[model samples]
Target: MIRDKSFYKFFVILVISLAFQNLLVYGVNLADNLMLGAYSEKALSGSALCNQIQFLLQMLVVGAGEGAVVLGSQYWGKKDLKPIPHIIGVTLRFGVGIAAILFVIVFVAPTQVLGILTNDQIVIAEGVKYLRIICFTYIIFTTTNILTASLRAVGIVAIGYLVSAATLCINICLNTCLIFGNFGFPELGIEGAAYATLVSRCVELLIVIFYLKYREHQLNLTLKKLLFIDTSYVKDYIRVSLPVLLNQAQWGIAQMIQTAILGHLGAAAIAANSIAVIVFQVISVAAYGAASAAGITVGKTIGENNIEKLHEIVHTLQIIFLGIGIISGTLIFLVSSPILEVYHISAEAKVLAKQFMCVLAVTTVGTAYQMACDNGIIRGGGDTSFSMKMNLISMWGIIVPLSAIAAFVIKTPPVVVFALLKSDQIYKILPVVIHLRKWNWVKKVTRAEI
Candidate 1:
């Protein structure tokens, strides 16, 4: 019980720090969407569609960062700081390579990707312009993610929150000036949002690079480190990262499919669903950040072979997430209407968003549970294979099919489809609960001959 209390105290701090970090990411997103919607309704939908491609790319980058956290936490536990450079180098190399390829696709074939998301000519034109302006931002954004993830792995979570705050401020200032034609800047409209994002990302990259130079011990980036390709370390990184990458791809594609389904309902549904998702993500990232912190802390503990405290820590983290989930979800439900007003969507769309948010509010606990157990506890324990398999079954086998049935066979409303899509979270809880209780996840993964 004493151990539980101690863990809870630490977890509370983690949650608070993560809330600030998420404030930066989500705050920028909120302001970006509002500025787009307020300036031009078409821009809102267009940016929404363009962001689908960007979102998939981001998932890949974030997955690499996640892999970085997994390795860095365990490596830090073992006091193996020597290999930190190699790990960062390998992750960044692979990430940058992938981002280059994606950038080509976005630049060379922007319309082709937009076509997959929508058929509206106006949306397609705006989305194409948005993609063209923002494609270069991927390189900068990917680097920021890798650097931030490496820092977090070394217990520098506060820096990430600070960076996020800085990014939010820069993004807002640039967006306002560029979007609204302030300070004699041409009113670039929707395209201005893209340019603002691009400029802000560059600034974020510069900050991260400057910080890395000053704090070289925390980050081990060097010319030789970047040039020297260690096959063995690369192999280990791939072994753990591939499944996670696949999991993210599967989850992201499934979401795109769900979005396409919502698209068929009407433009209003698309706009409303997009608005609601951004709002919910702001709330959700708090829990997400906490879970990320938990995974790192737990992985560090297991690295030291402190097996006795594992279960207590996991339980405490789970409880912390539960309380956050409940309270946050309830607030979301109560203020759903006011929140909807922030978006200039239709009245019908607002109603649908409110109902969908209510359902999301009720399911937050389940979502939080999965984040702590599956994402933090299991993956932190080096059970990546199991985590991948579970997401495959839950997202692909259950959620996709159910969403399709709701959309096609039942011809349900978008709200109903959105609700059905959330079933994966509910269905996933049982396996996570069973897995957590077994305590097999307590073993140290660093000694597994990586």
Candidate 2:
């Protein structure tokens, strides 16, 4: 315990910092949801659907950043920060490329994508308008995410928190003007939300560029590095990132499948489930923040060849995540109803959300273990394959199948389907928790060229 104190301290501070970051990011969407609901219920529903599609687009950026964490943390740990800038450049380029692809898909084919989520003509029409308007912003937002993530990987936590808070304020202000046509602005309603988001993202991208050019010290991302791709570094980046990319993609696909299944049940189920998820995500960000810091800390230890200390840090982080689980879970359980009340859904949806939130509350510990092991330990050590395998098995092997069977085959309601889905966390817990005890996560993984 004494030896682990520093690790816990680091995790606690990281979690607190990241919690605010998550609040800023997710808080914007939540506030948008509430504001839209207050002004127009139909607009809120349309925006919710568009938000789901946006989440899917953002996943690619997330995958790329996660890969960067694996490489950046280990390299930074080894005291080789020279390659850090190149890594950032490479990751940002990939983010931009993916964002471009998603933009075309969402803009040129908004109806096609929106159709996949739902068949409601009203929802799809509104979603299409929102998607087409916001798709162009993805390139900017995704690029910002990679740069911001890389910055955090190298101990620049305060910047992300500060920038995100500022972004949130800017977004809200824009939302007020655009959403209600204040001060000579046109009233766009749901489209206003998309416009506000795009403006905020542009601001975020500008801030990132300013820091990267003058204020930043991590990378020297010139046009040559950004455009003239080094084949070797690109190959290695793909090689190291493949497993992580697959892991995130597969997990995302499974989640969409779950959502599809719930969609078939009806709109109320979908809305309630969605609300519960976003709220749960708010708390889960705490665990993710701990995992982020732990991954960097452990990767640095491995790069420096401090195997014993790496082992100690892993153990310490796992414990801290567990404690967070207990506290976050208890808090969610106590506040589930009040939180659900914020949504403008029907009484049935409210009750279902409460039940869903309750089940999720209990499973927070399992989530902590998986995140710490998979993100903080395995991927931190650049052991991406095992992390991929664990997630694939937990998501595909356990969660999706079981939930499908329970919900569709057994004719279960939203409550039971949610319980089945939450069971995935429990399955992921045992194997990862056991693996954490082995202390095999002490290895260096980085090319000198980086």
Candidate 3:
């Protein structure tokens, strides 16, 4: 639908950079999974459980950042730079608050928290070891994410990937030295993985700080701007960002519940689910990236008041989303066996992991399209409430209840439960399509005078 070569050029470059950055981020997790799987299944399972807590923090932090982008991009489109620093400031406040609260909860009751996920005492012990060390990174990760998100809104995305690349390399090297006790380092096992991640997060934060202080010229963001924000934007921010925050919180809790259901099944299900999830995340980075790109594009377009071209732009993006979905799903199917061979898990775990990946492969087609359509286009256009409503109805009202019953009452196989848990990805397409046709998602979230 789009005949403009420039649009394609910009979209391709942005999506690739965002996707590669996301890939590097998940690559850190892949490294941890691979190293710990080789060490022991208990260690792998523990770290994965602990990572769920981390994932919840990430969802909150990302929600705050996405809120900033939803507002900041429109300002950027209008070439209004003054409001952005304030938006970042507001976002950072929420990010730090969420991180601090999570750190406290985890630190106080590590075992109690992990216990909710699984019944294995050995897994709980290992998870405690990892959680103790990794909890320190929560605030650090949140700060880095918010800062980088501010940069991303204004089209400075390359630095994010660069920082992730540094984090990935550092994480791998440290993991190699600590996990196996190579090069005179202590063999901390799961603890070593946690330490590696902590160090990498510190390094990532440092890099972003240096870039914002020196290289970034757009906003010239400094401590003063970050600390001294315009309080007037708080109401505006809360109005637009609350739904996104709640949506993320809802989704994060749902994921933990899903994990709990499978965890109660057995250790094998937990380990297999972990492996399958990491692979799916690694493979679907491009799809997620496309969503991020869509958010920025849609938000900026709305900000510019370029309503006439919106339909063409969105249509083109949908086509691209479908293409990315097909390719990513096929790749997941093809690479499942070879990737499974790298893990040193049991035969039962490997088989379940493969089946889980196949289900993800099919659902990914829906995910790529619907995620971009809803999270990217709709939410990005300032209808954050719509996503909250959609997720509430689809995930909580339908998927979670059904999946819980299947896992608990029906006592279905793990694969069937997993498929049910993911079916929302497919069925969500109908509502998203219907919603897109109505054209009510377009709204200018920016202010007339800031």
Candidate 4:
């Protein structure tokens, strides 16, 4: 129903850029998965387990950055640029501290940590080898993500995809040469994959720095600005950001738990789950991009006090989200078989993976709609606590417990347990729809002066 041409233009640009950027980021992981899968099934399983830790770190760092974006976008809306640097500073301090802590833990107890995910000694050993090298990229990745998020809050999204493209290319080429020992290079196997990712992280950081220093003019950010944050904004930042942090952390931990449940099933289950997840992650980029764009748009809209257009915007976005969900689901369903064929896993693993993807294909529709609505519209409007509460209830209270019971007690099929784990995407729709109608999620997070 929305008729504004400029709105469509802005939304389209942001969605395409952010989606491509996300695609490239996942493309790096896809490269790792593909290369490792070809090397050996053991190598792929081990690296997949190690990547779970990386995924957890990503969630935490992204949670921190998103908190800043929520605030920064509002400030950017008012054309008030002074407080944003402080917001970035607050974000960096928390983000880096988290990265450092995780690095120490991972470096200190690589085997013990991987043990929590699966009991397979072979898989754990492979994971440990990959973890030792890949863990080093944590801090570097965090810094780049937070910086990129700062740009995104102000509607500058092209840099993110561009940097990711460079990283993807570097990762793929290195993975090819190092993983296979091609062109006289020493074959590092799983170790080579870890090294390739580590190098890509460093290069990604450099690219982000170059762009910030030379290309970006709005914030004119300096090392000084990052080092000396206004302490006054710390409390405000925590107040708005803590819930989001906890939400993401809990969500990340929940995913690990899900992995652990499936990991206990067998190596085939672990390998299958990993393959299915990568495909879903790649194809769902558009859905995620829509959520990110929605957050920025809704946050900026509230900051501008353009409440009049809010209803139209939300309605129109819902339609777009539904369409995106259908297309994403179809793509996942169509590509599931061909993608499975590329993996050098057992036939049993391939069959299980296909089943998982089928489940994801159906759940993705609910995910696209509910994720965009909750994350983009509600949380983006400054009601961060809602999602925190909703996730706690749905994930912990319902999905996790039921899935655990199904997987362990009832001895359900792996596919059934996975469906239970993802059922939140569907059941949450009613509550989210009800809450959106109430309109209480709209709150201006910006202050008169910092």
Local accuracy of candidate 1 as per-residue lDDT tens digits, 156-256: 77767777788888888888898899999899888888988888888788777777777656555766765785656787788777877788777777777
TM-score-superior candidate, 1 or 4: 4
lDDT by residue (1-450, candidate 2, tens digit) is 436666657767877786778778887787687667666545665677777766765666777887777777777777787666667677877778877877777778788776776656776687677777887788888878887888777777776777777778888888888888998999888888888888888888787777777776556655565666554567657877777777777776677677767766666676677677777777777877777777777777777778767666766666777887888788778878777666666777677778888988888867776776677777777777777788777788888888879877888878898888778777777777776667565555688553
* Candidate 4 weakest ten by summed lDDT: 441-450
lDDT of 3 by residue, 265-328 (tens): 8888999999989999999999999999999999888888898888899999999999999999
Off by over 4 Å in 2: 2-11, 180-185, 220-225, 448-450
Q: How much does candidate 2 score in TM-score? A: 0.92
Error of 4 at 347 (Å): 0.7
Candidate 4 residue lDDT tens string, 361-449: 99999999998999899988899988889999988899889998999999999999989988999988898999999999998889976
Per-model root-mean-square deviation over C-alphas: 1.9, 2.3, 0.8, 0.8
lDDT of each: 0.78, 0.74, 0.93, 0.93
Error of 4 at 188 (Å): 0.9
Query: Residue-pair clashes per candidate, as listed?
Result: 0, 2, 0, 0
Model 3's alpha-carbon lDDT is 0.93
Return the TM-score for each candidate structure. 0.95, 0.92, 0.99, 0.99
User: Of 1 and 3, which scores higher on TM-score?
Assistant: 3
Q: Which pairs of residues collide in candidate 1? A: none
- Runs in model 1 deviating more than 4 A are 1-9, 447-450
